[model samples]
Target chain A: MRRLISMLCLVGVVLFGACALGKVEISGLFMKQAGYQESDIRAMTEEFLKMRPDIDVKLSFVAYEELHDKIVVAAASGAGTYDVILLDCIWPAEFAEAGWLLDVTERLSEEDRADIFPEVLSAVTYRGRLYGMPWLNDWEYFFYNKKMLEAVGAKPPTYWTEVIDIARKLKAQNIVEYPIIDAWGQGEAVVIQWLQYVYAMGGTLFDEAGNPTMNEGKPLEALEFMVQHMDEGLFNPACIESFYEEVRRVFSAGQAAFGLNWTYMYNLANDPAESQIAGDAVIAVIPGFPDGRRSATCNGGMGLSILTSSQHPDEAWDYIQYLASKEVQKKYSQNALPIWKSLYDDPELIAQQPELIKVAKEQIHYIFDRPQVPWYSQLSLILSEELQAALTKAKTPKQAMDDAVSRTKEVMERYAQ
Target chain B: MHSKVPPTPSGMYPRGGLLRRRETAFAWALILPSFVFIGVIIFYPMGLSLRLSLFQVDLTRRGAGTPFVGLANYIDILKSGYFWSSVGRTAYFTVVSIAIEMVLGLFIALLLNEKFRGRSILRSLLLLPWALPITVDAIMWKWIFNANYGAFNALLQQLGLIEKYQPWLTRPWSAMHCVIAADVWKVTPLVALLLLAGLQTIPRELYEAAEVDGAGWFRSLWKITIPLLGPTMTVVLVLRTLDAFRVFDIVYVMTQGGPANATKVISFLTYQEAFKFLHFSRGAALSYLITLIVAVLALLYTRAMKRQIEY
Candidate 1:
């Protein structure tokens, strides 16, 4: 019995020592939809695991809609639920303000900072402090069925005016019921699309003195333009109920001559298995107003962030660095563009999707951000509801903008207090 | 199957003895776990939310201290246009759906109560809609009402009722009605089952006596059936009203309170305030208001139920 007891004690010590040298387990939260596909992420993780067998990663996914609230809840509880999380560009202000994200400004080297696009880096920065590494690089691009444009004997449009003329011809000839389709749904999608128009029109939501400028100038004009075009049946009425997925489906169905969506749509739109107008679908720069500015696109990049409450912050940061590394990102450039500006010049990288890389080079130059505020969610809600009111004719464009202007001013003032 | 056992003596369970004490102690021991469970599961959150609501707890405001600004959150909610409009929408959903459901449920229950062929199979089949999960039911209805390729539009088109497919969920007014329709469709079956149970309890002799005295079917329905079914109807209304007034899942799956916030019910608003915006105190206050509204509604209904109709 004494010998058996000593042998058991020896076994217990061995097991504990083995455990001390075992894998460091960390979990990451990623959205199942858009940007990097699930299979791509799993493959990336598998590769990462092969390289670092001493570290174990557990990945979980939620829909994009649930990602924000899920992060907020997990962070608020201080539960260390996730070590790494996918961060939307619009969320950094709110998350950083809540102190839910790790401050990693000093971790980025000068060489690393210089290689990445400044606009891409801004997605992960709040108040000049870097919080994460930019991973998915996405922006809206104009898509058109080449056949429909050819049927109307029109060339590819460079200006909003030229697009309008082509859309008019397409409508008059009965080539399509609606020449243009967009996602103007009642959420962040609506605000992003609307802001793209506002940016294209050379409009700012605030003046130099930080006064609200939504009720006048091009912001008001943008809303009026949408209401008028929708009434003329140029914009699809169904867009009011559509999100990005719906926009992709509608554009792929050959029901619309023109549409705007993020990078994922380009591949899906041309896939023979997914689309009816597979080969004819072409991507170009989203048009801008000739009188106002050059091409404008809404920045839709997301980032790899380490949660402040993560127990294994070093392991999480290592995983994020691996995911956002130039080589890994360049290899997985099927769904999205790489954030590194140098990759755009790489022969093999450009060879994968030459047309997209060519347009993305110019499009990235014109990328504009959504308003980065801590109360952005509230501001987004106000924008979505007011924009819908104008679209649905519940209020005139002027009235809707006026209400939005006042509410925006009030929210800013509250924050200022 | 065997010989009968004798009855226990009257003193077997003496009220004032040591065995009684031991039995009492055992009963208390068995009940203690559930009592603690109720306190933890139900009362703990209630207390936490109540405490949180009294303070200004906006997480997004970073270092802003959570001050005890009692009743300020409630006042702000009452003053907000969003809250009042959401309340109006919730009321519209509850009243319109319950009115239609009660009438339709009673009519279906009356028909099912009659002698018929394949009655047993029909009765069992009636439960399918009620048995479906709300998420699945809402998703099914969302597809059925899809603007581009929906079964409803196809049916309407085939019948020459319209020239083109209508955007049913795109419009604010129509979207609310579509949501109410989805809720009503899933719930009316359960309502019918409840009414059918009440129908079974009605004595057929009352109808026979009335018929002998020259009363017709409509008269018997109006004079006898309706009044006796009052208690069951009251119970159904209370359940349906509470459920409809706090609707979130169907609206969430279908419209998500879209197209100018037309279908934004109170619970959806509360969710947006708390989680989406991270204004915990405001959300807590909004949820407490919901609790108060439901409690008051249930009380009024039970009061009506208590004043039972006399024959």
Candidate 2:
């Protein structure tokens, strides 16, 4: 019995020593994706591990809707479980303000900073300090069925009014039931989609004093136009509760003539295996109003940030740096539009994803980042519900816009106090 | 299966006083672990939530210290239109769903308790829906309620019940009913099974006696069966009411209070305010209000149940 106990003690000591000598372990939480995108992220992790055998990464992925809440909950607990967190474009302000993220401004070298796009760099900056490394540069693009348009001999619209007119013509000609579908679900998607219209109509959500000014002028007109389309049955009724995936599925199934979706949908809709309208889908820049005002799409991109609670911030930063490197980004740019500006003109990349560079270049020019406010999630909730209320005729467009503005202003005031 | 034994004689417990005290202490010793466990897991969270409700804490706002607002959070929730609307929706959801579940569950339990062919198989089959995860059940129903090409619209179209596929979840009026229907489908089996257990406990001899007394089937059910099942009905109602009042998973997975915030229940609203909006203080206040409501409901249920049990 004594010998047995001694042997067991020796084994335990060896195990403890082995564990102590093991590589540094870091956990990352990211929003879940599918197909090549999911696999591409996995490959990136493997590559990072290969590059630094002294570090091991545990990546956890969740749905997009749950990612924010999970990050907030974990980060609010001060010392969270995750060492690294993938944050949405709008959440950096809230997370940085809460002091949950580590400031990495000094960590990034000048050359590394210069390699990334200025707009993408600005996205990760909070209150003049950089908190995250930009990874995925996402923005909306207009997608239309080539066959559906050709069936009616109609060209893709350059303006919002022409979109409506073409939609009416397509329906009258029995080419398609409705020509437009949007990710107008009562979530962040709706707010983003609605902002496109808001910006297209030459309306601004906030003024010079940072007050919600959506109650009148072009904002109200834009909202009324959206509702009028819904009333006219020119918009897909299902779109009232559909998100990007749903919109992608319906449009790729050739059920709709045109849709407003993110850049990622292009790959899905163009892949013959996943999409029914693989070759039939074509991309275009988002349309503006008939007044020839500049068009805008919500600038949506996710970045990797080290949590303040991370025990191994240096190791996490190493992996993040590897991910944000131009070489890896060039390889994975097809999965998520690369954040680095230099990769856009890479001959090999342009050959691989031809239209991506073209359309993304234009879309990036008119990118409208979500309000850079700390209470953006709450503001989005208020705006989206009010937008839905207007669309559903529960409240008039004017009333809905006015209510949204007042509620947002109230929130701002409460926060100020 | 044996006859009742008579009470022990006085000599059997000459030192009953000391023994009783020791037994009481032993019983407490056995229960002490569970008591502590419950106190930590349940009561501690409740106390913390109550305490937090008195303050103003928004971690999203920079330099926003947790101020001692003392009933101000509750006041703000009361004044907010969103909170009241959510409360109204939750109340409506609870009442309507409980009503539907009780009636359907009772009838199904009655039918299930009968000695019919395939009764055993049918009994096991009824548990399938309840056995599935709520998220799975909700997602399945979401697809069924889909606007473009859902099973419901397809079935209705085939039967010529409607001219076209209708978006059941888009409209406010139909959306609530759709949610209730999904919830009822998922939870009604548990209620039925509970009442079925109650029905099985009923003595066959009492029904035989009623028949000999010239009481019809309905008469015996009304006079004997239901009266004996009073305790069971109260348990079922209380459980169902509490569950329905705090309905979140189904509404969350299905509509997410969508189309126009038509199905935003208090619980989902509180979750949004707390986690999504990062307004933990307000969420706690709303949660406490819900807890108060539930406590009152439980008290009323127990009081009414006591009278029924006595009868």
lDDT of 1 at B21: 72
TM-score per candidate, in order? 0.94, 0.94
Candidate 2 residue spans exceeding 4 A from truth: A1-21, A33-36, B1-29, B209-219
Residue B185 CA displacement from its true place in model 2, Å = 0.6
lDDT of 2 by residue, A1-417 (tens): 999999999999998997987888899987765212667778999988887888988988887888888888888887658988887779888888888999999998898788788777777888889998988777788999999888878887888887888899888987877678888888888888888898888788888877788988888888888888977878988888788888888898888888998877888898998899999888889999867366788777778999999999999999888887888888887757778877888899999889878887887878877888898888999998999898888999889998999889888888788
The candidates' interface RMSDs, in order, read: 0.9, 1.0
Off by over 4 Å in 1: A1-23, B1-10, B210-214, B309-311
DockQ of each: 0.69, 0.76
Q: Which ten residues in a row have the lowest lDDT in candidate 1 chain A?
A: A408-417
Tens-digit per-residue lDDT, B110-228, candidate 1: 99999999888988999999999999999999889887778989999999998988878889999999999999899999999999999999999999999999999999999988898
**Candidate 1 DockQ vs. native:** 0.69
